[model samples]
Target: MRMMVAGLAMMPADAQDIEPDGPDIVVTAGKPLRVDAKLLRAAQRRFAEDRPAHAPRATLRFELWRGYSRISATDVGLALTDGAGGQLPVTIDGDGRVVFATLPAGRWFLTAPAQSQGMHLRPIVLSSGTSVEDRRLGDLRAQCRVMVAMAKADASLLAMPLIGMFDAIGGCASKRFGFYHPVEHPLASATATGAGVMRTLRLSVTSTSYEAPLSDRNLPNDARVRLAYR
Candidate 1:
């Protein structure tokens, strides 16, 4: 059971909470309102977090894909948890989504407690496809829902994409392949504002290789090449 270990990751840069596309306001209600730094920080943290105690809870739905296509994941388990490592009840719904069907609106992550060499915990990693491909078509990085999959009973869990290439030029100029790092990373993450509302986070796990440069040269688009030689 050979598995490709991942390399150092460029944790998909997350989207900072920002005022929706508008500009114009000056210094507020005419007097510098001195806010307690701690309180201010707590307020800002709300955007990325909520409490199950926040009442009525909200819904978080996930649509994980195979790179940039409509094809979806199948036959896998979703391991969800909170910042403290308590398991959050997550499931795959009828719509083929990994969901916290009803959870307190707050920051949620997909990871579990792993005592790997004094390592506190790492996100549960899942690999889709014969070799997951829908995840690497672009530089689009998202982290509202931390990602890692449990696809095989005995599989090597990697922390990041094992290979990366310039999606446009379709070449190995990036030199992202054939590297390994010990760090494990999440697949996706989100702060569900589950105030009886549903938030959807979409992700794609991609693994790609250009066959033209290989010995066969005529492999199918879905060819499963050895990651060691990609």
Candidate 2:
């Protein structure tokens, strides 16, 4: 999509200059219809526009935790939005994770209202008609890995107090990694430091993936999201 906002100037350059060299091969007869560059560009533009039939169906999963424990049946609400904020249908289990199976193909926005203390979101893409049990189990497993990693980080901080503090506060302020302080105010510096470390660990554990949904929604074939706390 065109990346423009107030006061942002588009860079002027020759198309050829911006293009990169890639492998070239000649097309022969007896092959699938070859798409021209212009046609491809048009298709891309259509997808970006969030046109109907370009929306992909997806299943999302949510995993909640309190110190490495999975909490089930927490309230979850999810909706997909196009890049421009158009809503798409989305489904989630009581735990709040969306199944990849149910969504149509297209760009989607998945959101979960903050539930309980320390709830994390893990959004996944599934092809349409994916078996319910398979995706459910898969979501659980993915969340478990994240929980294990968070637990590991928590363990590391217990041994070195000063280093942990520096790692939490100093490291976050510098923006060295995706780490950040969690709470707006820390009752004590140590508490804040620990919270920051926890945030870093959470960010590190979650990731997003794009795959064809089982049912054809006629939307974009892929989706993207990161594990989000907000």
Candidate 3:
């Protein structure tokens, strides 16, 4: 949205020295949101008492969706990994939401299954004394290739290790790519594509083209690559 980085300060420059670039990148701001303060305080207490062994405590509410409709994702198994060798299991509630009460106050990688598709959520940050309540992460319907492409284009999207591994493994037998407008920023899609030498990948909304390489060091030189999207 406004591209607000947590706990970061803004730089100041003289207005006379500034000049316009070719075109300004526009970022749309989302609705203002806040978390439950009481819950956050309790979590901070738990984190302080637990010390090095335990992660901070906080609650997560994942609103599951299918296209534009809200759907129940109860019992869906979610894998949580915090890069620092921490792992946990998170399950959705009967109301299609995930209520995770305790987690570290840092970015995390979330992998889950939605219907017949795989969902990946990365850089899910949980502040030490805050809960993720009103804001929504990226959509679960997005395909791995689309997500991977976004990660490739944006370093912030690379928070998911598995997605990085997918890019590294190379020989892609098949791939599914789909783009969705992030809930937090409805004005734009997660990524934009461009043309290159290899295969062609199109993003419907952006109409941007990008090359899809077929060869990988780990795979045979003649290995075929396939891509799909829903």
Candidate 4:
């Protein structure tokens, strides 16, 4: 996938200058994208030419939607525990996410500091499926105008507030952390969304992962989305 028409504003680096420093693969189902920023623009052009035409759908869009922001967490830490009264090993990613490499099929508890100190809920009985996959952009507020977006069919663009906070003029899903990441780290969301590349972290999760459905809602309209998965 390539970057879409979100107004790419980087000083063009000739294609010959790109050195193969990492993997540059198509972001397909169950596959992850890992590419270097230096090679991004050239990749976008390459993919856009070969990309297929969509059936006049809404523009592809990805944004750091203010509607999905979480509440301001106070040193909000998370932990995992096994049912055997034992603690499980866990780690925090750069994005402040609790990651467990492999979870066995057994009852486990995720501990966190919520509203009340004595607050404790039953171990969640879940069916292993998440509809909306949102990975919060960490510390990107200063870079708001620099957001970049790409389309699955090789469309890519940039979101610059210099264009009037044009792409990013709203809020976060939660008000916790201020979202920056418009296009600095290449925050990308195009007028359309397909398997386009954005930042480094290719999505192995979320809406696009399921492929475009018969009735699609991921339209594009220049929303200022923070860079995620980078």
Q: After superposition, how far is residue 55 of candidate 2 from its true place, in Å?
A: 28
Candidate 4, residue 184: how far the Cα is off, in Å: 18
Candidate that would win on TM-score: 3
Error of 4 at 2 (Å): 34
Task: Name model 4 segments beyond 4 Å from true.
Answer: 1-68, 71-74, 115-190, 193-230
Q: What lDDT, from 0 to 1, does candidate 2 have?
A: 0.28
The residue-by-residue lDDT of candidate 4 on 81-134, one tens digit each, is: 555776654455443333334444455544443332322111000112211222
- By lDDT, who's the top model here? 3
lDDT of 2 by residue, 197-216 (tens): 21111211111111112111
TM-score of each: 0.22, 0.24, 0.26, 0.25
What is candidate 1's lDDT per residue for 1-230, written digit by digit as tens? 11221111222223222111111111123332111122212222331342222211223233433212222223434454445655555466564555433454454444322211111111111223322222211111111112111111112344223322122322222222211112112233221122243222222132222111111223222232222312
Worst 10 residues of 1 by lDDT: 136-145
Ranking by lDDT: 3, 2, 4, 1
- Name the better of 3 and 4 by lDDT: 3
Worst 10 residues of 4 by lDDT: 122-131
Q: Candidate 3, residue 57: CA error in Å?
A: 19
- Which lDDT values do the candidates have, in the order given? 0.25, 0.28, 0.30, 0.25
Residue 152, model 4: Cα distance from true site in angstroms: 28
Displacement of residue 34 (Cα, Å) in model 1 is 35
